[model samples]
Target: MKFEVGDKVVIQHSNDEGEVVEIINDKMVLVDVRGVKFPAYTDQLDFPYFKRFTEKKLFPAEKKPKKYIDQLPPEKPAPGKKKERIAQLADGVWLTFLPVFDSDEFGDDVVESLKIYLVNNSTLAFNFSYTLTYSGNSDFNLDGALPSMQDFYLHDIPFANLNDNPVFGCDFSLMTPDRKLAEHYEASLKLRAKQVFGRIEEIRKKGEATFSFKLFDEYPLRPYEEEKPVDTLGLGKLAGSGFRIYEASNGAAAYGVGEERA
Candidate 1:
């Protein structure tokens, strides 16, 4: 509602979620991130957004129960908490995300649809739209297949692949446009996938699979101010096709669709 000169806030208008780097006059505060500065009016803002962390893991020589892992507690312990830390680290604490991924062999495809569901659903609203394009390459693998990285996401929240297919899913950076919903949604998504699929990794197609759509992010109907162009991303160099996110607003994002700028 109100922003002081030095408050760290996330702009709901866009997902940049930068710190309130400086106050410019009475009406605007400049948020700077990654060497970029954006000035926004106080009226179009929210403050004190949540922070995010890369997922970490802890392990002790003994064994931790699946229930504890299943719980997916918000406060993850370090490699050790007790002398336990020593024991956990002594033998060697290997942070293997693949181990968790390896367990869910069955939900591989489900993970795909789930992420598509979340993104599509979340961006369905009138305020914003997200599109998934290929930036560097098209196919994640030579076979034109995706990594199948045990696609898992939360429920209640919505997501979609602009092209209407999902293969690899990514994390929502902390200052996501809708941080609260994204976090809760991702948590529930993580916990539920772990529970239902178990740790075993397997691939199963839930519904008919087909490439029905080409992914695209919506551009502003008309540009108003400094935020000039929209951004897009493509698959990547590995896939042999390149795309970038582009709109009248952000101009062109590094990633989009096809071999050209989307």
Candidate 2:
């Protein structure tokens, strides 16, 4: 019955499959089916993977093997060219911008595409929603959770759009696993337009592999502060032995003692 957001499950009554989006309580959860979300009890859901194994018969169905084309590895920059840079956005989160190049049919001219990655590098897991903005009026959204030490690919931004909308900023709202609903932490990450665009142009002219920059390395989020422990040692002894107060004025002195009469 254990479940968390992003886990795949099959609904009991409908027998439809979907991902767990929100957990209401010990017995309830919300699931996303296609684009619609429905409330379902935890007891009514089963692991989708297990169902596939249970439904398969002893005899395997005959099917033709599908051929897959091997993808070429990303091209590497020349030895002297700059390398890729990874930037830390918040406490356990990292960001990086990359340019991927493609060649024309003749393999003479090059085309460029941009991609941004947001990585989770902390011990704790988190669910997050993000907004990336540029040009002052344009924006895009990427919503999902990244488990501990995982990575999420944002999207491919076309090279043509960079000129009109150069500078970019990202805002993220994250909820940690321990206090998923209690605390909503926010972080704002900014990437300068000049830096990115200049590098791209330089790499293009130099025929380098790609352009990269390292910014805001391991920037930390505001940490949670725990309460201090109470002092109990001396207080217990002082309560048992009571105390005495002595006052002196000029040459005259007065003394008072207090203790448990019993």
Candidate 3:
């Protein structure tokens, strides 16, 4: 008999019942049994209605009175809440690369691509700008704010592009509320093909998912300078000194005394 989709059928040799999900051909059909799909011959499947009716008629079910209890069963105690544990990381900004592998039945794996991430493991928040370049050509550029103890995702690099040395540059500034601005920090890293291959081999040996290199240990800050009143008239220092100030061609001040320029 031919089976259509959505027809309930039973296997001819076994008691397993399933639904015909798709008719592959005149002789083959797709059956879904317990949420698993497999191909079976159409002749091996039959309608389950006859089998269910025959079983119900041959062995009739007996009905019994419902039992009632005076007391309810004890309830199970609720489980206590678990405390969350924070991960402790080293203090620095890091550049990490995670390799994606494609493996075959021969157990040989090839690197398909790489996932890049910028890790900010320090306590300070910073606004950062990043640029990636190869062979004097810019590949990627991004600017954003990164929170403390967080990671930012950069673009991926294909395995083939690793042969070309890529340069990564990052500029960071503190996100502070103070009026005095701190000096910006700059860092650059150049990746060579040999260096990356060595790191990848190391990761494969150690069974690590990612390889990381520290960009900087700590963020540098500029020294704070006290404010002082400006000398607008420039008369304070000229009171006793006989030197005369002359403006040079380069817009610099030249001092002279008695026709002798210094």
Candidate 4:
């Protein structure tokens, strides 16, 4: 495959699309990727353009479904207030939590719901278990895998009956395709329960039914420890109260069967 100095191409290894800017030799060329230029090999590149079946069409095209949102956008941030940051659970997976309202089945009533989105922002793919706990109790749980550059909804909790629960905890455990634990992330969100209710109540008094809020602020994910291996002989000693001495196959000292030395 020959590439010219102005051909648009994608790097096979990184999948980063760029255009050829300079040709150094037959094997290498300088590619410009979003204003950044890097040397790439011709064998590690592919052209983004192809001949179309219709001669009248100049470019190739593919069909994709459109995404539709039913809820209204959240209110803008006040002056001097910064925008919330995106939360990263792992190297690539991002987590976001927001409150929203949707119409009921009858279309006559507005129902409160919480929206949880797990976005796979990197090329790595993995599965995860998501657990949401509040007020010392479990609220919602989900288990699934997210593909590259995809977003998933974890849950949509009904907010109308958050009577005694406001503070919430979230746990995410990531696993590879073979089901081994890769990483774990946990965080807490303490909503201004009373103030949130008060604001909603005031809005209700004005005869409005649907609303939304960027409820939780960004939180950081910390490293979590994995489970430790248990000691078999130590378990036996705790099962009974006696002094004994014994040796195991691995040449480690162990408690004997009811033999007293002291």
lDDT of each: 0.33, 0.59, 0.74, 0.56
Across 1-262, the per-residue lDDT of candidate 1 in tens digits comes to 6566567676564545666776544445556544445445566666543322222336536775557566776876668322111001112111111111112465342332221222221122322212222333333221111111111112212222323232332223222234233331111112233332443233223211111121223212222347644424433442465444345555534344334634
Candidate 3 off by > 4 Å: 1-89, 104-107, 177-181, 223-233, 236-262
Give residue 237's lDDT in candidate 4 (0 to 100): 72
The TM-score of candidate 2 is 0.39
Better of 2 and 3 by TM-score: 3
- Write down the RMSD of all candidates, one decimal each: 28.3, 19.3, 16.0, 21.2
Cα-lDDT of candidate 4: 0.56
TM-score for each prediction?
A: 0.19, 0.39, 0.54, 0.33
Candidate 3 per-residue C-alpha lDDT over 221-241 given as tens digits, one digit per residue, 9 for 90 to 100: 566788988979785688558
Point out where model 2 deviates above 4 Å: 1-92, 104-111, 166-182, 197-262
Better of 1 and 4 by lDDT: 4
**Model 2 backbone overlap count:** 0
After superposition, the stretches of candidate 4 with alpha carbons farther than 4 Å from their true spots are: 1-94, 97-111, 166-170, 173-182, 194-262
Q: Which window of ten consecutive residues has the lowest lDDT sum in model 1? A: 84-93
